[model samples]
Target: MSTTNTDVLVVGAGPTGLLLAGDLATAGIDVTLVERRPHGLGNMTRAFGVHARTLEQLDARGLADELLATGTTLTTARLFGRLDLDLTRLPTRFNHLLVTPQYEVERLLERRAVDAGVTFRYGTELRGLRQDAEGVTAELTDPEGTPLTLRARYLVGTDGHRSSVRTALGLPFPGHSVIRSIVLADVRLAEEPADVFSVNGSGDTFAFLAPFGDGWYRVMGWTRTRQVADSEPVDLDEIREIARKALGTDYGMHDPRWISRFHSDERQAPAYRVGRAFLAGDAAHVHSPAGGQGMNTGLQDAANLSWKLTAALRGTAPDPEALLDSYQSERHPVGAMVLRSSGAIVRLAMAHTPLTRATRSLAAHLVNAIPPASARAMGMLSGIDIAYAPAPGTGRPSGRRAPDARLREGRLYELLRQGEFVLIAPGGPAPALPSTAPVTAKHLIRATWTDPAKRTAVLVRPDGYVHWTSN
Candidate 1:
């Protein structure tokens, strides 16, 4: 057996893990990322839509523009039925969503992590773990089947829904499957639609098609009238036929990149942390794919925890215990809200009753009539409205991410690029905190175009949320 040590050991190299690793490394923390899969990026487009909040986080890391180039920018998203609601009224620079595959986002983050010197060990599986008061010891198996032992002060489980770390801690993942089965396919369409996304609900079935680049479209719909037997295999031809019927077109489907059968299961772990180990991303919660919030939510989870963990490791602030508890206090309720909202979307769209359809159509019309109300609703769906409560005993602003502003040096996205605790001091010189203070400080003589002068100084976490501010 071989032995290694690190400040933090992360399990799973997916979006959550990679984002966390990048943040940690950029903050000068020693991080080790281990994955069972040999390849770093998976060959599947599980998620497609990067929302406003996520783009804000990525912009801090200076990767948003590159990502936007690979995919199409969607200024409008409409819900299909007798009536439609346009999503363009949402208030954000990224008010328009970017329709890029999940793999591309992962690849970009991985590159950033690697550049930051994050140690990534592919083909390494976490077999078991034991925690003491001081730290955690993880048992891992390498690609050649050699056993290796690692010690770390903390461990994070970004290992997806069936997380070994969460399971080993005996946490309860409680939820029920709302829908029996759904079929999703990624294929090239013979004729692409001018609209980026389309939804049609006419009968017992509803279908959604989102077109990406190169004539590729993601087609999703419910299985028809026959109750799906557990033993029956999902038919790709049937999925395409559903598209043809709902879309009212006989577009040829060819060269599928990925085919999947999914169920709308709404589950969340009872607790996010146990001892020295913590759960994040899909490991902590999962919901229906209705609002396309899965990957974005997970990425936000990583962003929220990274700065707190970095602060704790540096001993720049108070007790680490309080910092860890804040993660659950802030993210758990948000996850629950997402689960409820997405479940409602799925149920509303799949409703078969005439009264239900009428109600939905009326609701859509109402939302369209009131632009502000529609914008607020779309902000929630797009995750642009996330704001975490302040840590206990810290007189900080609660429930809003800090706006990205240009620095005095005229550098764009400068505050986010540092990946450290930043203090925006306007109308005064920067506060002189002790060098040993856990956070880094930056002084701006005056506020920039984005950051307004509401106060003397503003303290931002690595995730770009305003933690503390002064007037």
Candidate 2:
């Protein structure tokens, strides 16, 4: 029965919550982050690949170089049996995928949040939440089982798939389990493969293995014949055999450090925001791990939601209602798209029907043979091709992600580190806007506009998406 007050309350200290907390704290807002677990970072992680656009977001925040140093970079990603999505010619500075554990991402974001003086409440559970006209009230239980109350202008839920906050709001997570009884193990391979990632599956078995930058590797396998309770023990020999059945060779796999089992589902919340409470990360949507986009998509959600929340709570935005509503309008579709794409990949990989198997094989061969089709596939998987459709009556290029380019002073991303809107005026002196304008004006930047012939100014959001362009 004690009470606390803050500008923003973020539930769940996973990658999503950590990144949002860091962004808000860096913007000089009072943020309180609560985690059910006592510790912040863990050694075990399920995600490994950081896609290109995510790397660009981290680079804008000045955290990408450190991460790049700690992980392995590969310019090519194999997809759908024989098809390959090459990132070497992608249009971003980080034209390759970074393979590292999810814990590394959490560590960096946590450091950023702590350095910004964000408050942390470990070993805490959210019992309930209620929202009114002014702010939100959160009911929490501490590690010692002491009940507490919190008041904040806004509350965000970044909890995992079974989110208490989402449940409290009476939202439905609509989807079904795509696969079950997936065997997961963290071990060291006797001989590492030359490829950064190896994945294969046929009939009823599927397997994949990726390195953690060090000598250790993470092996994942699923067999339709072995559907059992999650609590059932996983045998190392069975795992090796399944892996061998799917992949040509296990590459002398041995020395298991950790072993576990899981079931993957494709679920997404109907709505991201209800009143003052919002959902992000796994709480919002979850899909199959075929594209390694689960964690990356959640991180992107954090990047998208954080700035809007900051703008709304700080009362500096031009229209807080529109700004807040845009969160769901923009991210929900992306979530649906990821679910469909990943589900297709899983279905193709785990095909039991001869028709599906034949279709998958033909699609792979045709995509590989067509250069344009393969390039598009690479863009989608790498996240470099994501573009937001403009809101009604807005400019055509308003919602697209602003690509990084050279400026007169430095790089485009460098100027975005302050977590503010950037105005690009390249040709001559920048147009003078009112001091009360919601964007920051930067002149003489050698960046291109979507329509170079007529654009006098272009506006980029703090999260690197274009908001408006003057013609």
Candidate 3:
């Protein structure tokens, strides 16, 4: 057996792992990313919507423009077949959700990682891992089926559901299956609908369709009556019948490129971190794809963890263990919330009883009629209103996402591409920062502060969250 050492080991080269690897490599860390599959994307795409906040995060890395160019932007999101979440009103450059395939997102992140010198080993599988106080030892097999060993100070599992890393750590994925044997197909529509995106349900069936910005469209349909084994083969007629029953018509769907069936579960791991290893993305949580949040949540997880890991490894973190521990505390609740919201959407969509339908209809009307309710729904789905609590004894407004604003120098996010904390003070030199600041801080230009009345200082984290604000 041969042994290789790296500062950090990332398992699973999906969006989550790719983002984390890219960020870590950019911060000058020796990170290694391993994937079980070869270096290429399949035609199938599970996620299609890139919400506002995810675009913001990617914009900070200078990767959003290219991705946006490859997709179509839809400013409205219909919820529950009645209420609409107006995405255009969201306070961001990307006020609309970019409807594109998951591969587009993965491609941008992969390019960044490759440019940043991140080592990628394709066709490799992790057999097992053993972690102790010192570090983690990973047993792996390469493309040639040769046994290899890897040692790292920390390991992160961004693998999807049925994660090997989670299994090795014995993390219990506790939750039940929400929907079973749903049909997915990528095909061409001879008759395009008026709306670029649509979701509708009738009786015991649900269906959704969204364009891929190309000639193809993704069709997702589910019928309670058609429940079958995942191994069971599916044909175009079954998909058309389900769509016609759920959405009134199949919209002349034909020329199937690929078809498959999958089951969704609402599961969360007991803990995201265990000793020297951590779980993220689908490995940490799995939920119904009601809000198109599955991939977005994982990408955000990578953004949050990448800086914390980099700080710990570079000896810049004031309290390394606490910074690392915050990963689970901050993201686990978000995961639970995603499961709850997405589950609610799934249950409501699958509602068959008259009473349930009536109740759902009433709620939808209320949401549509109320402005505040509508705004909150859009913010939650777009992830703009995500916040955390103030850090203890910091006397600063912490745990809130720092909104992007223009300064004399440049945009707030554009300044963040250097991968350091940005501290904005009213005037003079930068104010004294908290001793427990997790990363190196860069002082913002005085012009960055819009208000002159308050001379307080605000510290923004590397991930663009407010670390502390002195008032």
Candidate 4:
């Protein structure tokens, strides 16, 4: 067996792995990405909604604008027929959800990664892995069933739910299926949906409709009266009937491009990091598709973990283990939150009993009528208000996301394209960052605020979160 080595071994070539690999390569880190499938993206998409925070993250990478051009935007998300989350009012440059196919995201990320020199091993599958204090060793089978070994300073599993990497690490994805025998239909609706995004449920069924541009629609339907195994052949008529029951119409859906049946589960790994190996994306957490958050959450996960891994491998981190451990500490809670929110939405949509039905209605009206409540819900749903706690013994306000603060030369996100920490000083020229700060000289970019703002200087992490605020 031939053995190869790299700084990072990224398992899976999906959106999460591609983004993470691209970020590392952009930072000049060596990355080797392994995928079980072939070298081309199949004409399918599992994720259709890209949240504002994800677009912002892509903006930092200089890819968001191009991606935005490939999709339609939904400014308002209507759920349960009454509750509406106004995405337009979100406090970010991208104030709407981009209804694009997941494959489009992968294409951009893969191109970036290739340009940055990421080594890709498509048609390769991970059989198992072993990690020690030094690094991780992956046992893989190549395109021709030839066994190979790969060594890396660190490993990340962005592979989906039945993750091989997580299994090798002995981590448990603990959760049960939330909905069974769900059907997905890709069709051209003769009549467009009234809302750009639509979701509703009656006692007997639930339906969600979102566009993928070009008059194409992705419709997901579930029927309480008929539950069967995933292998059961999907009847398009059955799906349309369920949609009509829940949504009051199927919008004249016909000529299905494709249709499939599957089940959705709400699960999260107990731990994200185990030794030198880590879990991310669906490998770490998964939930019902109520909020259209699956791919968006995975993209954010890649963004958060990418830089930390870079710092650790670059020898710029003050404490590599602690910095690496932060991946779990910072992201685990966010995963739990997603699980709870998505779970609540799906369960509410599936409400059948009189008590549950009333609770669902009241909850919808309450969130709908209250401004603050609506704001919070939108914030969480859009991935705009995720904040980390202050690190222990530190009062530096280190965990909140810094707004795209303006600078004399350009925007904050534009500066972040260099894959470095951004130091924003109050007006005038940015002062030289001191040696005392926790970043290496090569990994810090200096800029001056466009306006005379706070007296305290701010350090933004590579992932766009505040690292610290200094006087």
- TM-score for each prediction? 0.92, 0.94, 0.97, 0.97
Q: Candidate 2 on 239-335: residue-level lDDT in tens?
A: 8998888886787888888888888899999999998999999999998988889988998899999888887876766778777888999999999
Model 3 lDDT on a 0 to 1 scale? 0.87
Better of 2 and 4 by TM-score: 4
Q: Report the lDDT of model 1 for residue 339.
A: 95
Best candidate per lDDT, number? 4
- Which residue window of length 10 is worst by lDDT in model 4? 429-438
Off by over 4 Å in 4: 41-43, 393-396, 427-437
Off by over 4 Å in 2: 40-43, 432-455
Better of 3 and 4 by lDDT: 4
Kindly indicate the candidate among 1 and 2 with the higher TM-score.
2
User: What local lDDT does model 1 show for residue 146?
Assistant: 98
lDDT of 4 by residue, 251-319 (tens): 899998888899999999999999899888999999988898888888889998999898888788778
Q: Per-residue lDDT for 69-188 in model 3, tens only? A: 888888887765686778888988889889898988998899999999999999999999998888999999999999999999999999899899999999899999999989999889
In model 3, how large is the Cα lDDT of residue 305? 95
What is every candidate's alpha-carbon RMSD to the true fold? 2.8, 2.6, 1.6, 1.6
Local distance difference test, candidate 4: 0.89
